[model samples]
Target: MIRKLYVIITTSAALGNALSLTNQTKFKRSPVGGIVTVRAGYAQTPFPEWLTEFTGLTEWPGIDPPYIPMDFIDFSKVPDYKSYPQGVCGVNPRESCSFDCDKCVEPDDVYTCSKLSQTFDDGPSPATEKLLESLDHPTTFFNLGINIVNFPDTYKKILDAGHLVGTHTWSHPFMPSLTNEQIVAQLEWSIWAMNATGNHYPKWFRPPYGAIDNRVRAISRMFGLQAVLWDHDTMDWQLIAEDSNLRTEEQVYHDVQLWKRGKRGLILEHDGSEKTVNVGINVSKLIGDDQLTVAQCVGGIDYIHQYAQK
Candidate 1:
């Protein structure tokens, strides 16, 4: 009887310790006010291809999965505004239109900037400070609203270091799947959160997962924000957090090299992973001395609005 009781107690203690360890390692809630949970280790995706499919839902060339569920906004419901009278139609008038208009002109979807722009996404994490310290030059940080709220100090540090801060959205949802109102809400909430942190509202916004379209760009302009896309994707986000065989450090370098080829523009890296941070520390070697901010690369448009003015 004593042996049986001892076994029960021992089992209970083991289970309790196991649960404690799981809780400790699974998720670490941010100290500030937000739902950003930093996990201890990489959460590997089961089928890596699923991530590609999930992000590319809008542009899936093949037939989508049966009963693919999505909730898109009826853009027709949004009222339209005529182009400003002073707007320049285009150089030839028959091919394209100039974007320098008062009205919500189509966002200039910049692929390659004339100069190299170092940009990181999904950040303002604890790893961010390390990244900033390692870099000899400033880089643009496209921060999530949740992370900015949870780690305002980190966001401020990025700005204090003279790095540009851009919105990466509140919850990091695929923008194309959201309603026009939902999309604007994401940007507005992020801008407000950053402003609340005593930083200027970010004028540039990067759509999560690189999923965006004309409608998304139009709505972004409604909030006086511009959509910034990447010319080179380092795939650093997948280096350690994915189940694919391409999750090695070598793969990251290879991907960056392949994307660079002989072009200079906005290069995408993430500051959310330690592995990525390491990559960022050495990124300058690949891109050379042309590191620039988004605004600088995009012709020095004002990409930050002071909160006090708003």
Candidate 2:
């Protein structure tokens, strides 16, 4: 499968800790929250194609004791994930574990909940415009920074419609394969783009392909993002029906209907394409107004933006 920005959170795995300073930028000190002190890691000139206007700096102090990386990361970049070595996934305990791989570790990354919930991923897409139009209540959309840039007007419309927005990374790359620094670049850049575009700082972070682990989780936590996974997956990305999760239109509708109220839980849907968008509309209707946004379903946090999430 192409896995074009698939859903859910997975175990985080890393190739190595060695950061290549070949093209790294200069930095200086900047303190945050009085408790944590960090410096900015500026993006290299002629930055990565996915670079946003917040190209000033991407900073996260190395994972050291008593020094937590600040959540207010205004930096940006999409490090080439393929350039890094593919670490030994769930295969090696010493190495990282990828959600895409078997034997992977699992802990955080909200996959289930008591109340029913709905969340869309890899969007602000062309088709998502329709999805937004169909929403009756506050919904949560995990948007891609690239899509936000491509569909600036739609991105703004999402905010205007009162739907919650979260970061799905700058350019969707498999998280487990990226280094800690590279992971920081992908996440910070995406966060900066959303903040710059909508004046919104999303607290929810859904790793591409459900890929996350201890290292990935730690990095995301520093930036004040909660990684989300899913218990129910409609697999709306699968065009043809091979199985229930990978079913087509009618099957997907059947799949949605299968989830009885109070029984069904947090599901992974997409607005990445027109087909998915059409299904999303029906999914919402089928799930009904009782369905809560991820923020509400996973309630505890007061507001959507950065605050204290318990």
Candidates' lDDT values, in order? 0.58, 0.59
lDDT of 2 by residue, 15-131 (tens): 122223321111001100111111123221123233322343343222221221444532243222232223334433433444444424345456666656678888776677788
| All candidates: TM-score | 0.65, 0.67
Model 1 per-residue lDDT tens digits across residues 8-67: 111112323223433322221111112246634433112224324644433211111222
Best candidate, TM-score: 2
What is the C-alpha local distance difference test score of candidate 1?
A: 0.58
Q: What is the alpha-carbon lDDT of model 2 when measured against the actual structure?
A: 0.59
Clashing pairs in 1: none
RMSD of candidate 1 to true structure, Å:
20.5
Question: In order, how many clashes per candidate?
Answer: 0, 9
